[model samples]
Target chain A: MNIQLIAEIMGTVAFAISGAMLAIERKMDLFGIVFLGIVTAAGGGFIRDMTLGIVPPAMFSSPMVLPLAILSSLAVCALVAWLYKGSDEELHGERFQWILNFTDAIGLGLFTVAGANTAIDSGYGDYHAFVIFLGMLTGVGGGMFRDVLAGIMPAVLRKHVYACASLVGAICYLGLLCAMPRGYAMFTGAMIVVVIRLLASHYKWNIPRVM
Target chain B: MNIQLIAEIMGTVAFAISGAMLAIERKMDLFGIVFLGIVTAAGGGFIRDMTLGIVPPAMFSSPMVLPLAILSSLAVCALVAWLYKGSDEELHGERFQWILNFTDAIGLGLFTVAGANTAIDSGYGDYHAFVIFLGMLTGVGGGMFRDVLAGIMPAVLRKHVYACASLVGAICYLGLLCAMPRGYAMFTGAMIVVVIRLLASHYKWNIPRVM
Candidate 1:
């Protein structure tokens, strides 16, 4: 498989898991869990496609995207059921937090670059601001939807350097595209986002919030 | 101006006022209030345009939409400031509730028909399900976004028959298209939604909830 395809699959799986876990935590019904999981994986693409005027959206056109999201979400649900067995114990521990952070960072990075690349391919390469904004939006939009459905302020808007990490990575991708092969630029940009996000999480970095 | 233009303007103003009022109730900053107001006014059209593959979306291409939303929101803000005068009296009474309901219903009805018309004009008239869905989505999408930003369950999904009202109206529009002119169909459909919503609200009609 190509690197871009791999990144897309990995990002989809990670986001599905993230969304399913949140739905479970919220004690939502089975339908809600699956719905949230699918939306979290694909909602950003929907937004991106709409803005870029891609009819039917990539998620709808791609045969595997929706199926992948469904399978991943179901797998998460099965795993959680097997492990917790309906217990009320907290789902987070050190290792769990680490896993969540790692997977989320990877998903954010991959999706951000993917979105930027799509924008570039769609003739938006000249619009640096729009490209970067689309990239960041693609990375954060799903999570924002998830949070909204869960009746909470979007975490990206409130806490951490999540969106900033995506923003910086998009900028890096745009800068590198001039000096390197497209694939290399994408890889490097995504890696930068992943690294920055991981470090920010480890250091508890947060943007200033107005109280 | 055409009937469609008039409906669009009224919808924009009503939705903006609704969003601004909610923001004020939540004690958000000025920026938050305006942002929420504009999103509530234009977010649905964004979703619709995106799905229909309309580049730049109508809100961006039509200079009046955004400016109108901003001005309407600002007017609401000014009026609220003048009336409340920084006092914490509750904003709702019988008259206030009636006005809010009347305006919201009108906005919902007009937007629903407008969205369905757009869908039909885009050559999706044969797809009955898609047309109805797009219409209902246009009616409720902005309020959904507004509620999400305000950290509350979407009112359309919960209290009243808000979305259902839009759905019925869309179906009515489609049905009426066979018997009347497009303008008459749109007007009649919108009126149906407003009446249904008002009646539902007055009678406290609610869908079954899973306890």
Candidate 2:
């Protein structure tokens, strides 16, 4: 498979897991968990497609995306059920959180590059600001949706360098596109985002709050 | 102007006001208020167009919509500032709430009909379920975005007969389309939604919650 296809699949699974985990934490039922998962995985692309006027959105056109999200979500749910097994212990220990963060960063990086590439292919390559915005939006939009549905402030808006990381990655992708092949630029761009996100999380880096 | 055009304009203004009012309540700055207002006014149409594959969405294509939303939001902000005059009193008294609810119902009803009509015009007239879903989504989608940005559960999901009212109105419109002129059907359908919503609010009617 091409790297872009692999990135899309991995990103979808990672985001689905992230959303399913959040839904479980929110004490949502099975349907809610699965729905949230699907939204978290596909919602960003849906928003991007809508903004760019891509009819039917990628989520609707690509048959495998929804199924992948659903299966990943169900798998997460089943795993949680088996692991907890009536125990009331909190599931968000440091190690578990690290795992979640790692997967989230991977999804963020892959999706961001993919979004930028889509925009470029759509003839927005000259519009650097728009391309970057679409990229960052694709990376963070689904998480925002998930957080909103879970009744929490969006992590992208408040915590860490979540959006900042995406922004940097998008810029890097745009810059690299000038000198390198599209495939290499995309790989490097995604890697940059994942690395930055991981480092930020590990070091407890944060953007300063106004208050 | 036609009734459909009038409905679109009125709905934009009403939803802009609603979003501006909420932003003020949240103590957001002027930029925040205006941004939220535009989103609340145009977000639904944006979503609807994207789903149906209409490029550049109506908000982008229709020059007046964004300006209308911005102006309406600013008007609300100015009015609130003038009325409050540095007072510490809460803005959400019973009368104020009634006004907000009334305007919201109007917007919801008008936008629902507009959305359904758009769907029908887009050659999806035979798809009853899709039409109804699009109608309800266009009606409530903006408010959902507003509430999510304000870090609250969407009002439509929790209280009143918001989506249900829209659903009924869409069905009514579809039915009336067979018996009446298109314009008349849209008018009556929108009126039905407004009436049902107002009555539900006035009577404190609510959908039963699982809990």
TM-score of chain A of each: 0.92, 0.94
Q: Give lDDT: candidate 2, residue A25.
A: 77
- Model 1 pairs in collision: none
**Clash number by candidate, in order:** 0, 0
Candidate 1 DockQ score?
Answer: 0.14
- Per-residue alpha-carbon lDDT of model 1 for B141-168, expressed as tens digits? 8889888787778988776788899999
Question: Which sections of candidate 1 miss by over 4 Å?
Answer: A1-117, A124-136, A145-153, A156-211, B92-97, B178-180, B205-211
Candidate 1's residue-wise lDDT over A82-188, tens digit each? 88785666565566556656767777888898888888789867667668767887888887888789776676755457777898999999999899987898889
Off by over 4 Å in 2: A178-181, A206-211, B1-117, B123-136, B145-152, B156-211
TM-score, predicted candidate 2 vs. hidden true structure? 0.63
TM-scores for candidates 1 onward, in order = 0.63, 0.63
Q: What docking tier does model 2 reach?
A: incorrect
Q: What is the interface RMSD of candidate 1, in Å?
A: 5.7
